[model samples]
Target: MAPVTSGSTRTRSTASHPGHPDLAAYRARELGRVRFRRALTLLVMTLLMPGSAQLVMGRKQVGRLAVRVWLACVGSALLLAAVGWLWPEVLFRLAADTTVLAVLRTGLTVLAIGWTLLLIDAWRLGDPLRLRQKQRLAMVGLNGTVVFAVAGSLLFASHLVAVQRDFITTMFGDGVASAAEHGRYNVLLIGGDAGDGRWGLRTDSMTVASIDEETGRTILFGLPRNMTNFPFPEGSELAAEFPDGYDCETCTLNSLATWAADHRDLFKGSETPGIDATIEGIEGITGLKINYYTLVNMEGFKSLVTAMGGLTLNVRDRIPIGVPVVDYIEPGVRRLNGFQTLWFARSRESADDYSRMARQKCVMSAMLQQLSPQTVLTKFEALADASTHLIETDLPASEVGEFTQLALRAKSQKVGTVSFVPPAINTSDPDIDKIRTMIDDAITKSEQPSGSGRKKGPGFSKSSSGASTGGSIGSLSSGYAANQSADLSKVC
Candidate 1:
């Protein structure tokens, strides 16, 4: 039984066939080519349709297990997609839970590992010796790429989840909340200068943001720091201390915190006596109940603005970088750094406090308008770090999710403002009833069905000569009248 070695010796073999070289050599080469093709086909099948390669490779048990797991993962993903689409809050709640996030991160890591191993095994089964040099190199490169891409993406996602959890724990803590008042949440925003030394812990900037619980429409009421003769909340610790209203000489609105701090014994059992007393004054004047307060340190406040990559302001005048350095901020549309921005918001020595309040409101409106979700997420770490140091709040951790949802809704709507400064309604002798009526009317206007879109902030105007007339924000003019307009963007 001698084997035939040549085409002439082999039966029915064509000698001049283009498809045939030497009979035995050509047949062996053809088998090698077939093996290479099969290896590629199996690799592609496993990549796209997991477990298919194993089934074809006769690893029935491994194939069945892989197939079942793959099917379950797909089913779970589809179910989540459906729930997320229909009821997004369920997803939000689940995401907010640290335990859920931890499990998700762990599961992703494990899946990445398992998938990478399966892919490597599939590449080994491809039998690289039978492949051409180029084909073998391609297989190795492709396998390495898939492994890194999957594992790297999973690891990055897990890091983000961890960052968010850490942020939640540190910033929100375990604060106890006061009930939401009048179907709304009113948070007092205080920009305080603790280092000024003139009046201890003076809250130079104060604004009450009254947010509608359902609609998310917000009304910002600005109270001047120079405001005097305002009543305190009746029967509260502050009222008992300053019975005849806060009307002492040099007892400006900003000084209330210092007074409360100095006489903290009078506030008995209050943790942040200064803040609590300040809230009383604000509530009494606006006639809007204050639910919580966040005192932003003026020094650290610059870091926060920097973190947002600075805000754009249509600067109308040559604002001075007052105190310590007497340089001027020659104005146009300027992107200001932290120090320049703080001065722009708080500087009144150049003009007056009343005028600066309008500028502050403009800055506030700009933040609400420009601080989009995409921007925040991109600069997340910087913003998160800056915020933790800058903001001192009584807002509870549990309500953080609810407020976040509300804020997201608010972003799509125009922010309305009422500045109770100067000749509008004298803060020195403000009519409480009138203030309440103003707040009520603003709320009504904001709740209108045909909601007005955001108006451009006191836009720059030009004189007949085409020279810039400039707006009132950075100018010394009668500041924005309280309840003057439903949209502060227009009045800035």
Candidate 2:
């Protein structure tokens, strides 16, 4: 064969030989390309289907277990979403339950850890040691990024869940539940201040919020601080002390708190004697059985408003910031900070107590209307912290979920109000019969359908003869618009 071999035949033989340098180089290049493709495929599979990479790369048992768990988690999430959409109250109840929250937090933590380990295993299955330097570096970067992102999100969610649990446990207590009376819940709201030398808090503002149990329709019965000669419930300790009524010259409605505090023996074993006594007096005056009481600390209220990022109010007149008029909140529709709002609600400079009460009503309306869900989520932590200090209540923690749902329902409807001020009733000696009649009528009207003979309140009507007082739309003599309006939003 060597004697007469053709040149073309010789060349072909050389190319086919395993020992040839050119052939060896070409095979090496092909092998490198295959390894790179394999590495890329494994990473992509792990990203799309968490355990797929391990299944294909020889960890069948681990891969099967992970895939099954992932499917179960997805299915459970879909199921929960479906149930929540159908029954919103169920979700609220679950959210308010401490045990459920603790379970959720633990589940989230476990999920985060499990997901991270799976991602790391997927990277290991890619065989980084055999990959080219550039390919190995790229895979490591991508894998780390995904692991941190997923794990970080889950951990953050767990933290928020823990925060909510803590807030609920700390702020609310295991108080006895009070049943609704006559298809309604009458809650007493007291705005109090404990200044120097005060025996206890003096209630500057008081309102009985009578709400429909089913509809959440509300009517606010505002009691003046200067009101006198109001009766207490027949069987209450206060009534035994003053059989006729609280008729002494200095025995105004506001003084009851101090008196109750000084003589706590009357309210034996009671943590809040002042509030208990006030509730009894309110029940007799309004002829409604009070279900619960919420006392708001005036100083702590500033912190709450600040946490909410201030409130927008219609400033009808210039309000002095402090006594002797150091500074003034000028009139106009304006956004007021916590300090300014406190002054707006509390200031009585050049303004009577009735005028101050009117301003307080406006502030309450503005807070309710402006507090949106988005704001709550954004400032949830601050709001929770402030609320614990701001409010003291006998409302049961178990009822929080229900009341929360009710409050949301109330936001959509008009709020009716009836204040016992000036021309309506004499503060020195209020007509108990007339006051009760007004409260009954207001509640009856509020319970009616929106347009079914439901009369609207006298809202923001200028006094034809009297002038505006204390930055309110109406005068004390004519009745402040915000104090007795059917729709508080319209007047405020």
Candidate 3:
């Protein structure tokens, strides 16, 4: 061997002997750099493959299990995304299902905890204590940042799921589901207030939103609150009492709720006697089977508008603020706040009930058009809170997912409206048979293909010859544009 020694071998052996101070220092520096690179590589592997770091430098069994779980989770997510893209209803169903929400919440919480632990283990495998001071600090910083960021996001998602579940459970009831009648769902919408000296909440404004079961085309049948001599369903309690029609001076449609509340015995086993009685009245008038009823508290509704960041309305005229006219909401296309909107929808100091009804319809149209899914998601918590206080309904929670889908569909279509006010049908003595026929005709027309024998209303024309009756775009006798328009948006 001594005879066969080459120049290169002799130089390497001299360097290995550590007799040369500079050579030994160079070797130490190279070794440190190699260790640093190895530690950095393990951290990168942990980030990219979750358990690959453990497989190479830590427990092999743990690494295999972690990698398998990570793969399964990723695969399941991709599958769900694909399915959701193909059929969006499935996603809505999952979102609405309480059991699904609970499972999701639990899974998110578990993933947060599990992923944090895995990251900690990966950091430990990197052996940061053996790393140089700067490298160790860098690894610690990176691990902590990644752990908190991922865990925080998961935890936040879980919290949102929990909030939605609670909102659904608390807001909706376990009421019996009502089937759609004549291929349409007639939901009675009542807007009113429960003030002092009132027997119950007054049915100030009432409209039956008859929506097509399949197409979601809706026709709003605005029944005047002062409608008198209206017969109820023949077999109902109110019908028996008002067999000759509610023909007294105080026996108007709006007064029916108070009348029913005063005599609760008439509505036995009913939670909302006023609303149920009002629904019967509406059914008796429109001849449409009521599927459900949503009673909105006028006072609390202001909060909902505020939550939506106010509603943009075309205020045609100056609307008085208070009953005695304290302030005025200036005209033009303006974004009105909650207070102004409530006043715009409810104030009748100088306006007739019909004009107010027209404004309300405009408000509804604006809300439908402007309240996008993105807006709802962004302002969900605020909207949810306001809704709980604003609305009361017999709509079952089981049907929420379906109704949500219908609403989305409704948003895409034009809303047809029919109001049974003066000149068309006298509120004091409305012709029941004629009103029913008109409703049936409207529904039939709405179900037809767009632009097929359907007349569009004069939408928001400022230069029209029509008189501006109480800030609305038409005279009471001629009919407010919003009240009887094919597209309410035109008038608004």
Q: Estimate each model's TM-score.
A: 0.82, 0.87, 0.89
Question: Tens-digit lDDT track for model 1 on 28-130?
Answer: 7788778778777877777676777888898888888887877888898899999879976676666666667778778777776777777777887889877
Judged by TM-score, which candidate is best?
3
What C-alpha lDDT do the candidate models reach, one value each? 0.73, 0.81, 0.83
Q: What's the lDDT of the predicted structure labeled candidate 1?
A: 0.73
* Model 3, span 177-272: residue lDDT tens: 899988899898888864564423698789899898887788898999889988888899988887888899788889888888889998899877
Quality of model 2 by C-alpha lDDT: 0.81
Flag clash pairs in model 2: none
Candidate 2 per-residue lDDT, tens place, 23-73, comes to 988887787678878877876787677788889888999889878878887
Q: After superposition, how far is residue 208 of candidate 1 from its true place, in Å?
A: 0.9
In candidate 1, which residue pairs get closer than 3 Å at backbone N, Cα or C atoms, i.e. clash?
Answer: none
Candidate 1: regions farther than 4 A off: 1-77, 129-133, 176-178, 194-200, 267-270, 325-330, 334-340, 451-477, 481-484
| C-alpha positional error of residue 343 in candidate 3 after TM-score superposition, expressed in Å | 1.7
How should the candidates be ordered by lDDT, best one leading? 3, 2, 1
Candidates' RMSD to native: 5.4, 5.1, 5.0
Residue 362 accuracy (lDDT) in model 3 = 85
Which candidate number would show the highest lDDT if scored against the true structure? 3
